[model samples]
Target: MSFFNLFTQKSSSKISDKKLKEMLESSTPPLLIDVRTPEEYSRGHISKSKNIPVQNFEDSIKKMGLKLDSPIVVYCQSGMRASQASKILNKLGFEEIYNLGGIGNWSYGLKR
Candidate 1:
């Protein structure tokens, strides 16, 4: 399936950056993930976002000890990696996965 198709197939799997910002303010915040490389993440990232490079996402998620249904939002330098990561998360049984597209599309600012 196309990357966009994945989001369209599941209502909970794709969220705009603006919506993600709003969701971050909720009482129960979703887990924010940066699916870029460690170096890319170190340069800058959303505050409170965990860096889990897409190449090692599965193992990283396993090490995180999160529940299968935990709410999660993933982003990358561009949308491609994030979409791939989101699909991986879905296959891993994460029910509330949100592909927040690219960090470049995030207008709220970043934390270096």
Candidate 2:
């Protein structure tokens, strides 16, 4: 691997929408976050997914009152932003972070 790759590694953890739903239904659910624009989130988003725009991800997470090791699942309009957010979460000491990809990939419906 390149030297750059060693410093900027992406997380490998990802989950499908069905798995996300199942996890949500569990007694201990992961912290679901929508890393999309506020306007996009206002249009529609996954139920119980908090809108934390990717631009200010760190600040948003700090205000969420979550622990450093909280199980967090992040998504966006597409998978790109979620991937970036997952990297940030990993660096911030979040032990369990999962990228749920895009809301478009969600087959279980959304909340408007």
Candidate 3:
């Protein structure tokens, strides 16, 4: 891997939309996070998602009092920010992190 790949690389788990939808409806839904700016998130975001911008990602996650093993789902307007947040989550020892990529790719209803 090149040196720059460290910054651009993504986490291992990239979930399919259908699987994510099912997870959302299941009894134990993952902790969903929107790594977009508050204003962009205000426009529209996935239901059950919390807005935690990538820059503040680690601090916000720490404040949430979540467990290290809790399942987490993260997304952004585009996949880039989500990837960044996912890396932070991994470094923070979160075990089940899933990057759902771009919100624009989501086929389900968004919360306004």
Candidate 4:
């Protein structure tokens, strides 16, 4: 890896399901993001999560008005899509980002 790649700060933070759940239960929850398609999101998603289809992530982020230091939790049906989205957000300068793996580990009930 290049010196920059090795020494540069990570684009996003990563958290496990348990830690994410705890944060969600706290008084203030992180900005939960579901990077799945609309159809997939409609099937079920974590409450309070904003659905931004992977295809439109770049476009959607522009309107979010979120700070780079804000904590963001991203997830998808199986984890692949969320992984890509996490990387994209990191590249865009979002600092505190967490890839919550997948919706499969969500202990809380779904919204839909």
Using TM-score, give the best candidate's number.
3
The C-alpha TM-scores of every prediction are 0.86, 0.86, 0.87, 0.86
Q: Is candidate 2 or candidate 3 better by lDDT?
A: 3
Candidate 2: list runs displaced more than 4 Å.
1-12
Q: Rate the local accuracy (lDDT) of all candidates.
A: 0.86, 0.86, 0.87, 0.84
Find the 10 residues in a row with the least total lDDT in model 1.
4-13
**In lDDT terms, how accurate is model 2?**
0.86
lDDT of 1 by residue, 1-112 (tens): 4577456444336788889988899999999999999899999999989888999998989888899768999999879999989878876667788988888888999999
What lDDT tens digits, residue by residue, belong to model 4 across residues 41-104?
9998888899998889977887888887788899998888889898888777777889987899
Candidate 3 lDDT, 1-112, residue by residue in tens: 4566556554549988899999989999999899999999999999888889998888889998998778899999889999998889877667789999999878987899
Q: Give the local distance difference test score of model 3.
A: 0.87
- 3 Cα displacement, candidate 4 (Å): 11
Clashing pairs in 3: none
Q: Sum up the clashes in candidate 3.
A: 0
Residue pairs in steric clash, candidate 4?
Answer: none
